[model samples]
Target: MTAAITPTTREALARRIADLALAVPGRVRVAVDGPPPTAPVELAEAVAELLRAAGRPPLVADARDWLRPASVRLEYGRTDVDMFLDGWLDEGALRRELLGPAGADGSGRVLRRFHDAGRDRAFRDDYTTLAADAVVVLAGELLLGRGLPFDLRVHLRMSTAALGRRLPADLGWTLPAHERYETERSPGKEADLLVLSDHPERPAIRS
Candidate 1:
C-alpha cells in the first residue's frame, strides 16, 4: 500500500501546476488523467484553485461533460469494452467546442462545457475569453495518447489490485479497457508527470 500524501505535498503539487500554468505567455492547456476511482478531478480542482489564487483565470473542463450521447455510448451495450475505450468520449466534439478554441493556434475563447450527458442535451453556449496567460485544466480517464494539445500532462496511476479494490461493482466492466490502455498507451511513460495514486491520500510522484 502507498503511504498517505502529506498536506505539504499536496500543496507543493498545486504550486507546481500553478507554475506550469504561468510558464508560457499565451493560453495554457493542462490534462489530468486517471480512472474515475482515482479521482483526477479532485487534482484538477486543486490546481485550478491554486492558479486562481495566484491571479490567473483558470477553467476546468470535465471529460464527463463532453461525453457522447447515450445512444452512441450504449451502441455496443453499456458494458462493452470497445465502447468504453473508444466510443465514450466525443473527441471530435471536444476538439471543435473546447480544445480548438483554447489551443495555441486557435482563438483563446473556450466553451466551458458543451453537453450534459445525463440529460443528453447541448449545454448552453457559455464561452469565456481566456486571457493571454490563462490556463485550462481538463480532467478525465484515458486522456493521454489522444493527440490532444496540452501544455502539461499529468497521469494518476493505480495498480491493478488498487483499481479493482476502488472500483464499484457496477463500473467494474471498464477495468479491461483501462488495462488495455495501460498496456497500449502506457500513460505513465507518456505523461509529463506521473503520480502513484494507489492510495489517494498518499500519492507520490513517480520517476
Candidate 2:
C-alpha cells in the first residue's frame, strides 16, 4: 500500500505548478495526464485553484470533453483496446478548437467545452478570451506523446497492481491499452513532472 500524502506535500506540489505557470510569459497550456482511476481531474482542479489564488486566471478542460462522436469511437467495438487507445479522443478537433487557440502563437480565445459524452452531441459554447498570463489545465488519459503543445506536462503514474485494483470490472478491457502506453509512450519518463499516484492519498514526485 502506498503511504498517505501529508497536507504539506500536496501543498508543495500545487506551489510547484503555480510557480511554473507564473514563469511563463504569456498564456500557458498545462496537461495533467493520468489514467481515470488516478483521478487526474482532482489534481487538475487543485492546480487550477492554486493558480487562481496566485492571481492567474486559470481554465480547466477535460480531454473527455474532446472525445469523438460515439459512432466514430465505436467503429471497431465498444471494448476494442486499439480504438480506446487511439480513436476515442478527437485529437484533431481538440487542437483546432481549443489547443490551437490557446497556444503561444495563436489567439487566446478558447472554447470552454465541446462534445458531451453522455448525450453524444456537440457542445456549442462561445469562445472566451483568456488574460495574457492566463493558464489552461487539461486533465485526461493518454495526453502525453500526442505531440500536443503544452507548456507544462504533468503525468500521474500508478503501478499495474494499483491500477488493476482501482479500475472497475467493466473497464478491465482497457488494461492492455494502458500497458501499451507505458511500453510505447513512456509518459512517466517523457513528462516534465511525474507523480507516483499508486495511492491517491499518498502521492510522490519522481526526482
Candidate 3:
C-alpha cells in the first residue's frame, strides 16, 4: 500500500527535481508526462519555480504548442484516438526546436513555441537563451516511449477511475489514448521519478 501522504508531497517532488538540476552538470532536460487529469504541467510549473529558487535557470515547453497544424491533425477528424496518439504532435519540431538545441553540443537557446493548433498558424517569436546549466521542463501527455532524449523524466500517474472521474464530459473521448499509453509505453516504468497523482494536492509516491 502507498503511504499516507500530505499536501506537501507535490512540493517535495518539486524540491527533488530541483535537486536533480543542481546535481546534474549541464542543462537538465526533464519530461513531465501524464494525461491532463494528472496535471503534469502544473507539476512542471511548480518545479520550474523551485529550480529558479535554487538558482538553476528553468525553461518550460508545452506539447500543445508543438502540435501539427489543423490540416494535418484533423485529416482523420477529431476524436480519433489513433491520430491523437500518433499523428497530432510534431515530434520532429519538438526535437529540433526545443530538445535538441537545449541538449549537449548545441546552444542553450530555445524557442517558446512552434505552432499553435488553436489558431492554426506558426509562432513568430524568437528563441530565449537560457543559462547552460538551465533546466527545461517539457510537460504533456503521451510524451514517453517516444525515445525523446532527456536527462530526467517524471510520470504523473493516475488510476483509470481517477482519470475518468476527474475529466469532464467533453474530454471523455481522450480516455482510450491515455489507457493505451499506460499499457504500451508504461510511463511509470520509463520514468525516473514516478508520482501517484490522483489527488494533485496530495500525491503519493510508489515505494
lDDT (C-alpha) at residue 54 in model 1: 83
TM-score of every model versus the real structure:
0.92, 0.93, 0.93
Query: Candidate 3, residue 141: CA error in Å?
Result: 0.9
Count clashing residue pairs per candidate. Answer: 3, 1, 0
Give the alpha carbon lDDT tens digit for every residue of 1-207 in model 3.
655443447779888767766788888899998888777788889988988887888888888899999998989889999999988989999888889888966687789689978899999999898788888899998998999889898888888889999988998998888889899889888888778888877876664
Per-residue lDDT over 105-181 for candidate 2, one digit per residue giving the tens place of the 0 to 100 score: 88888887889989999998888998888899999999988888899998888878889889889998888898899
Candidate with best lDDT: 2
TM-score, structure 2 vs. true: 0.93
Backbone clashes counted, model 3: 0
lDDT on C-alpha atoms for all candidate structures = 0.83, 0.86, 0.85
Better of 1 and 3 by TM-score: 3
Clashing residue pairs, candidate 2?
5-202
Clashing pairs in 3: none
> How many residue pairs in model 2 have overlapping backbones?
1
- Candidate 2: list runs displaced more than 4 Å: 1-8
Model 1, 154-174: lDDT tens digits are 888888889999999998988
